[model samples]
Structures are given as structure tokens and as C-alpha cells.
Target: MLSRLRRFTLCSLALVPFAGPALAGDTSAWSAREGTAARLVAGGAQEGSHDGSLIGGVEIRLPEGLKTYWRYPGDSGVPPHFDWSGSRNVEAVEVLWPAPVRFDDGGSFSIGYKRDVVLPLRITPKDRSQPVDLKLNLDFAVCGKICQPANAALDLALPPGGIGAPSAALTQALASVPRPAELGARSEPGIAAAELHHASDGATIRIATHVGNAATADLFVEGPDEDWALPLPARETGADGRTIFVLPVDGIPKGADVTTARLRFTLVDGDRAIEVDTPLSAR
Candidate 1:
């Protein structure tokens, strides 16, 4: 946990961090407010696993009927972007995404969170002995009926022996991140078995997700990196009590083969969801 300095006013935060941003830091939770409130979290110093570096969490509060985007925003949504040029003492920031649900806006499909969400970030400091002045400039879009752009310019000041406190909300959000899984690794109970077949443009992914009512379920697929924008999964069912989703992969650059490319899946069953990362291959 990194100690927070609440010395800055909202007016200052809205202006200063925009000057320059470079994020690589250590510490717990620090929050700033905008249209939707955002908090910076410094983690790992609480449980005696003080490895100098910290896993940070950005807690975003979404009002009812409002939604934010995942890294890949499916058919018709803009993804969130971060600018760390305004930060200091930071080396790198790794964005970790939680499982997302598919939302139908008219006829277009989008993937994101309808309620509050916390995005886990891995932060590495340049020096452990030194403190970090963490700043963030996040640009994102929120949609309900009309889509609007949103921004959060947050700041956290920490000195030596300073750490941020742990947050239950942030902790739970981090816990919701997708568990790692391999292709055809169905031995894990309650987990869906995923397989793939080659297609003309890319590949087709089949996921054996068990659900009582297939109509109530939703599926989201992500590509290997942020660049590979795959489409949402198409839902299907068999005579058995299981449901299968066939996703046609596309959006990769020319000459890129999706069969050998890694993929991710997020299956949403009502309020419950699970995420997995694996590769696809021809049957």
C-alpha cells in the first residue's frame, strides 16, 4: 500500500498531470473524481509480499445505465486509451482487463461493464529507494443511449515509507480478472471447452459453454493483442443441455493467420461470467 497525499485540490489535478505523464510506480489506493470517479491503487505492501513493485488498480464508478468499454469494444464502441506522459518515477504500466458482458445497443453489439469496474494495472518503479509521483490521463467513452467521451486526469503523490491503503472494491475487481486456460483444457470443471477450425479470412472458434437457457447467455472474444480485433461470438445450441458459440475471427492484418494466433473468451451467463485465454487450431 502507498500512502496517499490528498493535498491537491480538484482544480490542480485537472490541469497539472496533463503537462507530462510517465507511469512506473509503487504503492495502494488513491482516488480522483471526474464524470465517473477513478482511483489509483498501490497494492502488495499489505500482505508482506512487498516486492518493491506494485500491482495497481484503477477503480471506475459507473452510474446506472451508463457503461464503459473493454480493451476490445466489439462492434460499435471506442476502447479506452491511457496517456502516461504526465507521470513520473514510473517505468511501465500493464493494463489488465476483467471479463466483459455483451450489450445490445439497437442492433449493434458492444462489450463492457454496465456497473462499476476496476481495471488492474501492473506498475514497475525505476528505483525502490525513491518515491513515485503517479499521474494518469485516461480517455474513454461511456454509452447508454448516446455515446460520449470521458476523461480522468488523476494524480498520486508518495514519498519514502508512504503507501496506499487496500480497498475491498478494488480487491474484488482484481479477483474478477480472467483465469488463465489452455485450448481444449476442459478438465477444469464448470469451464467451457474451446476448439477452433480454419476459415477463409481467419478461423472459427467453438466454445462449449453450459447454460440452462442459451438465449440468456452472451459471449465475447478477444484477439492475441490489442491490434487483432475479432468479432463477437455467434450463439448456437445442440440437443444436449449445453450451448456452443461459434465466433468468426477477422480484423487481423493481412497475411496474419488467426488459427495459430492466441485468442481469449469471456462467457457471460446472466450475472456470472468466466474468461479464458488460449490458441485456436484446425480440426
Candidate 2:
């Protein structure tokens, strides 16, 4: 039987210390953290936009020796939680996560950020003509010697024409987002191949991508939804002369047919990362 998996939330009672715009001069910043700050930015809302979706984001500047977690916090960290209850005209919120580095958190292996980071949001509005009032109550954990829980309430009213001045922080953040992976496409920032093998326990996923430096590379995998917590990936050099990563799948419903399951992989190498969703197979 498949057990229900809820959002990975930890217990905490620390006073929210962040709640305004970040220090990088974004006016929509809402500072509400202890050692970090948070800001909300909206863009791509111009005349005759073809995508029909608005791009928004939250920028977090991590001071020296501070770090934050990704959507999946690896082994023993907290994943961020966003509450859009106060949002107006928002139909959906699709979060775009950057590649994370693997490190030890509280003596346990984990995956997260070692420096400043940005979380871009792809928002679908109910009415494109109307302005969007983006209200975000973001709860995330930042760590140094101790893990600290922080929260920030931010609101941005995105009107047409977007920000007059281009924000370097946001521009860089948008660039860092992973490009979609294409198997056998033989392109820069693309996936070479991915293979999955099923077992009695669950499954093992193997992926290979083109990378310049293997030592600085890392791969992170995510399950079908926010509730599934998967293990970290192991890196190795394939016999076929490609950078390979293997991940063991475990936390899923018992007897669930995962032969056709889909998984998302984020390959992070230095300042570049790409994302791809690969389907599982019985073979």
C-alpha cells in the first residue's frame, strides 16, 4: 500500500527575522530572515507576450558561512515552504530551482546552497489583463553552526511594462535556471543518455551528461511530487567514457508500479545547471 507523503516540514519556533527587499536595491524586497534577506521580482509581463505566463522570483543573499536548502533538502535539512494564500489573480505557481551542491549538514550528508541563491517562479494568472498582486509568505531554513528557521511576508503588485531598470541579480538568477535536457541531442547543456533499472526494492536510475570538469559536478534527483523524498545521487565515470550518476529510489508506495514512473534530474556543474525529466522503464 502507498503511504501518504506530506510536505517535509520541520518543527521550529524561531522569531521571523526577514521581511523586506533584499540589499541589492530591488524595491519589492521584503526582509524577514536572521542572516539573509528575501525579495520578490516579477517580469515578462509586456505587450503581446506569447508565453502567457509571468516570471517572478525570490532572491536570497547568503552571507559568508551561511547556506540554504533546495526544494529537496537531501538527508537532514529543511525545504522551503511558500504560502500564496494572500495572492490575487494567481492560478498556479511553478517554482524553478537552481542546481544545489552536496555538503554535510549537521554531520549528515545533504544537498543545498553554499552561497547566495535565487528561486524563480513561473506564475499563471487568472486574468492576464489585470495586474497581479503577488503575496508570498515564505518559510525557509538557513544554517551555519545551527539551523535557523526564517519567514518573510512579501507582496509585489506587477503592473505592465515590468521594472524600468534591468536588475542584474534577477538577470543572473534567470540565467542560472537549468536548461531542459535532451537525450542524444548532442548539444551544449544537454543530457547524453539516461537508463533506469527496476529491482525488488525500488529502482536505480543512471544518467550521463557532457561536462567539462567531473570533479566539480553534482547531480540531484526529484520524485513525482513535493512529498516524495529521494536519496542523493552518486557520481562515477561510465565505461563508455561519460560522466555518470546513479541514484537509488526508495521512498515510494509499496507495490506501486514505477516502471513507467518519471523523475527529474538537475545536473549542477560550477555556475551552470540543466534539468531533465526522464521516465523509468522495466528493461
- The backbone clash count of each candidate, in order, is 20, 13
What are the Cα lDDT values of the candidates?
0.64, 0.71
What is the overall TM-score of model 1 with all chains considered together?
Answer: 0.76
lDDT at 254, model 2: 54
Candidate 2 accuracy as lDDT: 0.71
Question: Which regions of candidate 1 fall more than 4 Å away from where they truly are?
Answer: 1-35, 44-51, 159-165, 187-193, 198-203, 210-217, 268-274
User: What digit string (tens of lDDT, one per residue) describes model 1 on residues 113-135?
Assistant: 89988898766667766776767
Error at 75, model 1, angstroms = 0.4
**Model 2 steric clash total:** 13
Expressed as tens digits, the lDDT of each residue in 182-232 for candidate 2 is: 565565455777777778986787777788678878888777875566677
Which 10 consecutive positions of candidate 2 have the poorest summed lDDT?
1-10
Indicate the TM-score of model 2: 0.83
User: What TM-score fits each model?
Assistant: 0.76, 0.83
